[model samples]
Target: MPTTRSALMVAATAAMLAGCAKPPEAPPPSSSAYRVYVTNEASGDMSVIDSATMNVIATVPLGKRPRGIHASPDGKTIYVALSGSPIAGPGMDESTLPPPDKSADGIGVFDVKQNKLVRVIHSGSDPENFDISKDGKRLYVSNEDVAGVSVLDLEHEKVIATLQTGEEPEGVRISPDGRWVFVTSEDAGTIAVVDTAANKVVNSFKVGRRPRSIAFLPDSATAWVNAENDGTVVLVDAVKHTVVDTVQLGERGVVKPMAVLLSPDASTLYVSTGRGKKVFILDVATRKVQASIEVGQRPWGIALSPDGKTLYSANGPSNDISVVDLATRQVSQKVKLTGSPWGVITLEQ
Candidate 1:
């Protein structure tokens, strides 16, 4: 009944409208083969590797500064902390740096099976790191610039609360019992402990200079925090929230601890020494360094193998992953990558 020109115009308008419509909720990740996901901060991409073959499978492009990464309980999805903040350190003037890209500041959720980023949830501002609750319903994210912890409701995709923390919060972890959450403040040189049940900062204690990373034992009764500037790893009593012991990794300027991981049997703690070009293996009970293996240049993010036989570390400067054999306590292989890998996490079959 209408002219063809008018009908085509209407069809074009409808198509445009549909394109502008909001996207629907994404489905959960499906079952996939076991693989290791490495976040490359400099390249803004994630490198997927075949664990069995120790070969890189694919490179998934993400947003800027994909630093912290964690796998969901079911291993169906992986969350990445993508920030827009300008990187600053002890002596740098932050005012001279460019403004943060607000649009890129969010938590990127990658579907395991699809091997792609399906959603990006707002995480307040400059979420450098985060820890998910045991039930996978909440995220305690560290907002570096604002010095606050943003608690977001995972299912609803909304922030329910914001808890104050020390200046420049970075490292974040949840207790195994799910009773407490710990965030390390680099500038404050302290650990802010949040009582999840009360939804408040229950305690705060200084460990040493520049606490960057943390790891908990299997029982979660104790925690190890790496004091970067001090080049030491301090043990903390989780329940009491107090420093119990300290194990020095290397000389102050030579050995900077960036990441720590616990053995499955809880007998040892593997530490990645930034700029030290090595990973320190410490005996847990004795609190002493048993051995140190040369990895690569500035090994930052580290992860344990499923079978507890090998260790993987993301070496930033070298742009590769150092694979260490636990039994041999040495680096067995180095998987080459093109980007500056910052964080590493593994998903199993």
Candidate 2:
């Protein structure tokens, strides 16, 4: 009934409104294949590798310094810690590096099905590592530059708390029972225990020099922390939050333990030595060295396969992933990646 000119104007306005509206989210997948994700810190992208074929399937662009990577409890989403801080390795001069772009620091939320970054949650300053709650509502993130831990509420997408910690906090992990949140302070050489319910640090104890990573048993009775400078892994009494023992992997200064991962059965402990260029296998029951597999240069992040038959190490310097076959305790394949790979995680969907 309207004139052609008026009808065209209305149609154009409607189209503009439609373009401004938010796009609908991709529907959840009914089925998915197993894939390994690696975060490249230098190039600011994530590599998706097909587990069945042992080949890289896709590369998703993330942001600056994507270091820590973890999946949601439901395996629907992956959260990566992205930082704008300039890279300063051991013995490197920090003063020479450029200033940090504070705006680029946040936790990247990637939708597994879409293989894309859905959003970025504010995670305080310089988030290096983080762990999710059992129900997956909250994220305990280590604010490395601020020397504190930020508690981010996923539903509200806001930081609920910023708890204090020692200097240069890096590794973050929650106990299996979900009663405690553990954060490692690298420069302080200590672990801060946060009571989840109380939402505060209840205890802080020294493990050893330069502790960076933590692994817990299934029962949550004990935990193992890497003492990087000491070239040893320290066993902790998870309940008492006390150190029980230390297992030497190699000579100090050479064998710097970076990441600790436990087998599904909790029978074996796998440790990636940063500069040592090896993954040390230890017998959990006896706390003895079982074997040391040479992986690559600066193997920092390690993950066990879903079936528990293979291990993947993110070698930062080599810019590749070393696939270790657990049965042979040897490196079976090396998957090349662009940029410096910092963290690796496997998801079977």
Candidate whose lDDT is highest: 2
Q: Summarize candidate 2's per-residue lDDT along 1-349 as a digit string, tens digits.
A: 9999999999999999998796978753334357899999999999999887787878999999999999999999999999999988766787899999999999999998788999899989999999999899999999988999999999999999999999999999999999999999999999999999989999999999999999989888899999999999999999988889999999999999999999989999999998899999999999999999999989999998898899999998889999999999889999999999999999996
Collision count for each candidate, in order: 0, 0
Off by over 4 Å in 1: 1-33
Q: Write down the TM-score of every candidate.
A: 0.89, 0.90
Error of 2 at 9 (Å): 38
Q: What is the overall TM-score of model 2 with all chains considered together?
A: 0.90
Cα-based lDDT at residue 275, candidate 2: 88
- Regions more than 4 Å wrong, model 2: 1-33
All models: lDDT?
0.90, 0.94
